[model samples]
Target: MSRVYLSLGSNINPKHNIREGIATLNLRFGQMQLSPIIESEPVGFIGDPFINLITTLETELPISELSSQLRLIEYDFGREDNAPKFSGRTLDIDIVLVDQLEGEHFGLTLPRKDLFEHGYMLYPLSLMEPELIPPGQEKTVQELWQQFPFPEQKLWLTEL
Candidate 1:
């Protein structure tokens, strides 16, 4: 089984969506390691705050199949394909890392760029898997997080 890490976020009805999203993932992938939910302002657009978290699961499925499954989950929760790139979301789930594999798999980049670009993504990941070494990177997630400008991005842990 490959260890897969995913990032989930929601702005609209975040509490409900996040709970349902987690439940769905658990049902599909069995038990998962979850990070504390964190609330952060939307990036690249003006919208409501988003609740974000990272989850780790073990799956035997290939990246293509796993990605397809996640898209279905987001769609079931009311995600719109036509929505603007940085617009509000009912539920957003993205693959972050799949083991220590690098390069493109299933047409998606391993170790997503957002892993380092956004505090909302990096912080929760570091909390869950501090020693995780992202693909093609030498530093652990915790180490990268240490250099993150937390103050520059407004985010706080939520009670979800």
Candidate 2:
């Protein structure tokens, strides 16, 4: 089984989308380790804050297949075909890590870079799995989250 970590976020009907996303993860992937919902100001496009959460699961599917499944789930959650780039969609699911797989050439190395760059991802992650260590990163989720400068924004404590 692959230890899969995914980040979920939405600005439209934030609460419902988050809950639905969790339900989808459980129904499609496997049992999920869901984090509390966090709210952060729009980073790229201009809009309302985003309700973000992290989910870790053990899946037998390959990483590529998992990614495709996640994309389909996004569509099921109301993602439009021609949605504006980063314009606060109904659901956004990003693969944060897939085991220790790495790449030397043009391919996806395990542990997505957003783990450190995006506080929204790291913050909730700290809450979910304190011992989570992204591939190639020495710091655990708790350590990284502590290092991150908590953005002075809103984050809701979502119940799963």
TM-score of each: 0.96, 0.86
Q: Give the alpha carbon lDDT tens digit for every residue of 95-127 in model 2.
A: 887777654312455577777888888888898
- Candidate lDDT scores, in order, read 0.92, 0.79
Which candidate number maximizes TM-score? Answer: 1
Candidate 1: what lDDT?
0.92
Check candidate 1 and list the clashing pairs.
none
Writing each residue's lDDT as its tens digit, candidate 1 over 61-149 gives: 98999999999999999988788899999999999999888888879987898888999999998888899888888899999999886
Roughly what TM-score does model 2 have, to 2 decimal places? Answer: 0.86
Model 2 lDDT-worst window of ten: 101-110
Worst 10 residues of 1 by lDDT: 147-156
